[model samples]
Target: MSELRTEQPHDDAGLRDWQHVHNVIIPTHVLSLAEVRERAGRNHLEVAYLDDVLVGCSTVRPPTGDTLTATVIARTLPAHRGQGFGTELYARGVARARDLGAETIETVVLSSNEDGLRFAKKRGFVEIERYLLPGDTIPWIDLRLS
Candidate 1:
């Protein structure tokens, strides 16, 4: 069975472990540990653990007036990917947003990231808009859950 654990952003050791997992799992985004820590410190960040092992993390920033912006950076250790860690992380994030009085949550994903899109779809997220990256023509999709 898997277990989920939630903690504040400044928990250095937890954030470091999460950063390592994220670096290995996400191909396009090369986020540094410092960046992850900074974001976690800015908003409500949650981490998930499975038997003392770090598995996933998510960051949610509640906006004014019924909306929340969330970015979930989670990675299951290579051996745990198919066990639903990602889904659990997302569920927790959405629940946290709702608890914070947000009626809607928004997320963005790269166009080429099929796995992410699939995960979002499974979590009841629908594409609401598409925009190009600043320096490139690569399209990114914005998904919303309401």
Candidate 2:
């Protein structure tokens, strides 16, 4: 059986593992350990551990007094993918945003990432806008949860 636990990004050694997994799972540029530390320090970041292993991480920035934008950089180990870890992470993030007094939560995903888009939609996030990435053909879709 798997269990989910939440903790601050800086306090979780498993965040490094999550970053490594993210680098392997996604096609986007991966953040270095130092960069991840800096982002966590600047934002409200959290990690989800399944049992004793790190499975997901999310970062939330307060873009405005009433708006929090969240970015989830998560990856389940190969053996653990497709087993609801991402959903767990997202649910935790939503709860955190509410606790932080955010009236809305926003996130962006590459249009090519169909799975991510579907997941976000399933979580009640609506597509708000789309923008082209500089010098790249890929388009990014912005999603918001209220």
Candidate 3:
């Protein structure tokens, strides 16, 4: 893999990254640019690039108000899936969460997505809960950050 670069994306580029990854992973669940814009307003977003090309993105919505933990969502584009980009990005996400005093980091993976499941487990996350979505059940996995 080429040298990895990570950054907090700005405006339009951030929305595009969100939409692009959403479309790549879950085509049935598309997020409009406007929706991405709205989410960006509420979440911390980061994008990872390999050799200057966007390869993955990560978002973490830190606990606030009634919530006590953070939720992290990360995805790497198809072509860049298993070359360690996701893992690198996740490490940064966890670091950020720790800096923010978050006690736990939660991430969900579709039950059918074996790669995602393994990825989470490999990083010391434990399956803590499961929930049914429209057509699939997802496991809510978490890692202690504190």
TM values, all candidates: 0.76, 0.77, 0.82
Residues 63-131, candidate 2, lDDT per residue (tens digit)?
565344444433345566688887777766667766766677787777887777887888778889998
lDDT of 1 by residue, 24-61 (tens): 65555667878987767677776667778777666677
Error of 1 at 117 (Å): 0.9
Off by over 4 Å in 2: 63-79, 135-137
lDDT of residue 49 for candidate 3: 77
Each model's number of backbone clashes?
0, 0, 0
In order, the Cα lDDT scores of the candidates are 0.69, 0.67, 0.74
After the best TM-score superposition of candidate 1, give how far the Cα of residue 124 lies from its true spot, in angstroms.
2.6
Best by TM-score: 3
In candidate 1 the C-alpha lDDT for residue 119 amounts to 78
Total clashes in model 2, counting residue pairs 3 or more apart in sequence or in different chains: 0
**For candidate 3, lDDT tens digit of each residue in 81-110?**
878888887878877776777766788765
As a whole number from 0 to 100, the lDDT of residue 130 in candidate 2 is: 94
Instruction: Compute the lDDT of residue 119 as modeled in candidate 3.
Output: 82
Which number leads on lDDT?
A: 3
- Ranked by TM-score, the better of candidates 1 and 3 is 3
Off by over 4 Å in 3: 65-67, 134-146
